[model samples]
Target: MRTLALPAPRRSRGRSAVFLAAAALLAGLAVAPAAHAGDGRKAEAATLHDLAEDHGRYFGSATDNPELTDTPYTELLGEEFGTITPGNSMKWDATEPQRGVFDFTKGDEVVDFARAHRQRVRGHTLLWHSQLPGWLTSGTWSADELRAILKNHVQTVVKHYKGKVFAWDVANEIMNEDGTYRENLFYKTLGPGYIADALRWAHQADPKAKLYLNDYNVEWIGPKSDAYYELIKQLKADGVPVHGFGLQGHLALQYGFPGNLQENLQRFADLRVDTALTEVDIRMVLPSDEAKLAEQADWYARVTEACLAVKRCVGITVWDYTDRYSWIPAFFEGEGAALPWDENLKAKPAYFAIRDALGVRPKKT
Candidate 1:
């Protein structure tokens, strides 16, 4: 899960501190020509999906069940994107509220929308420490008991959406920032082997679906990312079913862009697996100024370029399309506007910058 706002700038003390200070240099990269503003007027244009498709990639966004009823909001999602990941619907809490029972109502809604729009679907997560049902979280179980439950959960969820989803984040945010596994329910009960077990179970249920281990803060080469690299490398050696590594590219302008982001993604690519910017949003401390917005746009363009540059980087997905429902403000005080579109669904500079980065030719009006 994404952490709170970045720590305030501090005097360089070590490698991490020095890397954090490099945000300024990252922001100084040459900016792309900005595209026209998204004025909410429907016009003939090269949509992000079309441009990305030309480059063998799919552009996507995450949407929640509540946003489905908003006609304009859904319209934008259906038109401008090629893939949809239900932000919370497919999580354990929403799927299996009780021990044995399962619910597909919320997740089905998103899948239906994607089908209607001819967009692909990505299963958000099967195992995550957060947003779990009370039943699973409150009760304690032995290692064997917990392992059985986890297997059942993974198998059942993967089987239910077998043919529908193209990729599944089998595990989410299992690693901490310091390159260690977080002591979550599964880790505490079953230990680190749980990751491999989760991936194996998911593959057993749906061999066709691409299984992935997804996390945030590993967009660059750091302790956190290094841990993932080692883990993924080991998994590959063991012939595990780990198919992809997801970088939940939740970025903030205050914290400089990740160092060697392209190189970091390339390293994962060397493992012969796919990579994606699973949940991308560049935020700044609120009351956004022109400079901050411009910087945000630059970051967006750079992220798109980074993915495009890497052959194994499949695509990029924003946390959501518009800032009306961004999770940043709710979690981080005085921080919002983390999306390419504004609360009013108007395309900000970042939107056009993305089009430029994707090499979309301007459509004649």
Candidate 2:
């Protein structure tokens, strides 16, 4: 039921990033940074991930198993990002499709790829309400039965990838937009204590791994974030193992950029918890024009700036690096072009914008 995903692997669209660049130029925009003769080799090769490291942060992207077949896509993904998340590979349905049985093949492929590429892996989720196995969702269970099932799943998954992953979104999207606990299977069966329990389980499974509570639409200051503020505060007071708050930066052009995003992240940092833009993507209406693309670039810059502005804002991860594998078209009608690179695997204005935000520049010849 994670409706936001419809990941079609390697369905590349469009032609000629040169055409994209020409259009951008005609619209009076500086295109993404490209290799130049006079540029130093190190600067020329430095990627977004490298630039982010200069700021002491990591730049990452989410990837799936199938997209690994795409040579060009995988090449850029591995080169430009320092971290990767298995978009759906690590979810409950994919990991443990049967009661008392676990499968880590899909998730392991991603981890292996990241390891080969020398990139760190972030375990996407140990528990979620959507994309659940039929048996678990269909079968009925009492509170105690459900609690044991939940605990086993969380700890087993966390331990399986124990030393490989540096972080785990122990629970995901467990809050309603209106700032109420989502009455998901766990919440309804085991009560809100499930979050604390899950976090503790993950911590026990891998003490070094960072544990996070992830949700979308909490980027800006609002009732939804207010709810998380109160929740995290109480969790800290109660000595829960909550370590980070993930703001899934899934934004739409029509909604306008989130207000006071830096201040919002700052407040969370003030709570002595780490913060990250877990899933960054900015989608726009279909038939995207130069203006829309430019606007998207501006938003990317702003988000990067906001994260850089905060000391504890650890890192940023695009939902994926390129629109070739983007989920926007499948999930949001008449909305696409949600990533820094277009479907052609060529960087766009947004890519350069992000680089500029990270303080990278092409030295003049």
Candidate 3:
């Protein structure tokens, strides 16, 4: 949160041809501006299960094309999952891998799908240290070049999506595990001030969109979490237009989840901004580990209950809808099945636990 002036750009080695091709396709698409239906009781009538509810701001998920039409995500979720993040559809590398080039075809598909279904969208991220084009990390551009690139990238994407997206994770995973700032390509090239600039630029692109700074492991009170807390306070004081904080609640049973999560959420609410339990999933070893499964269910219930208890905690989004699509196993190596539903689209025990925690009564067949 400390205001650091923008630093000099590192360098850029250039981008890949494949990345550039995809980016071009995104830029060429004819995206019509989204129409705001306004907030009203009629909009609220579409219960969280109706995809058209547009209120209560409950659960959301990162969806793909196949799932958009064929899976239970569209059917079972209905209006309940109002907000949609592009699982991996709108990353920096995907949107604009090369210089000055922008591609939003995949992301646009998501937007189109959401619009067709009458669901709201949350832009997954605008800036992040991960999943960036190799050229960005190559460190070839001057500070000026990088700044222009960053600004243009943000402006273009925001302009394209504008009213279609309700909120955005403007800057992601900027803090280190110790709660100190992590020096990624942006930080290394542009310095600490880049965070504020990113937020400001994103706001310029779409003033209506609620911008948020997102990170994982901030659900508990610790050095890292505290660092983010202080950072938000400082940004708020600076009048940065930062409207919310996204707690990437990716938990593991072995790590021993936060003991005082409800208190932690209240602290953020006290700051008078919205909060969301983004990318939530409690993972354990597979092959039906009943004891660990039970523990996972308990943890899921706790997270859901905590979010519900906090007034400003608007929504909770699982990383993936089903274990089959979960990124945990690939990322965590040995971690498996980390979602409310299994690959077969059957509800896991954790699913029922979360539903009950949310005060949602199961429908009798």
Model 2, residue pairs in steric clash: 1-131
* Model 3 C-alpha lDDT per residue in residues 1-365, reported as the tens digit of each score: 11112122222223233233323323443122122334553422333333212225467777765566665556654344666778777888889878777889889988987787777888888898888887777768878999998898888888899899999999988998777789887788788888889889988888999888898878878777788789889888998888899988887766666767888888988998889887888777655565555556667777877877787888888776788677777777677778877787665666545544654432345
* Ranking, TM-score, top scorer first: 2, 1, 3
Every candidate's lDDT:
0.85, 0.84, 0.72
- Scored by lDDT, the top model is 1
Instruction: Predict model 3's lDDT versus the native.
Output: 0.72
Task: Report how far residue 49 has shifted in candidate 1, in Å.
Answer: 0.9
Q: Alpha carbon lDDT of residue 209, candidate 3? A: 93
Worst 10 residues of 2 by lDDT: 5-14
| Estimated TM-score for each candidate | 0.89, 0.90, 0.81
Judging by lDDT, tell me the better candidate of 1 and 2.
1
Tens digit of per-residue lDDT, candidate 2, span 168-264: 9988999887789999988998999999999888899899999999988888787778999999999999998888999989888776777588999
| TM-score of candidate 1 on Cα atoms, chains taken together | 0.89
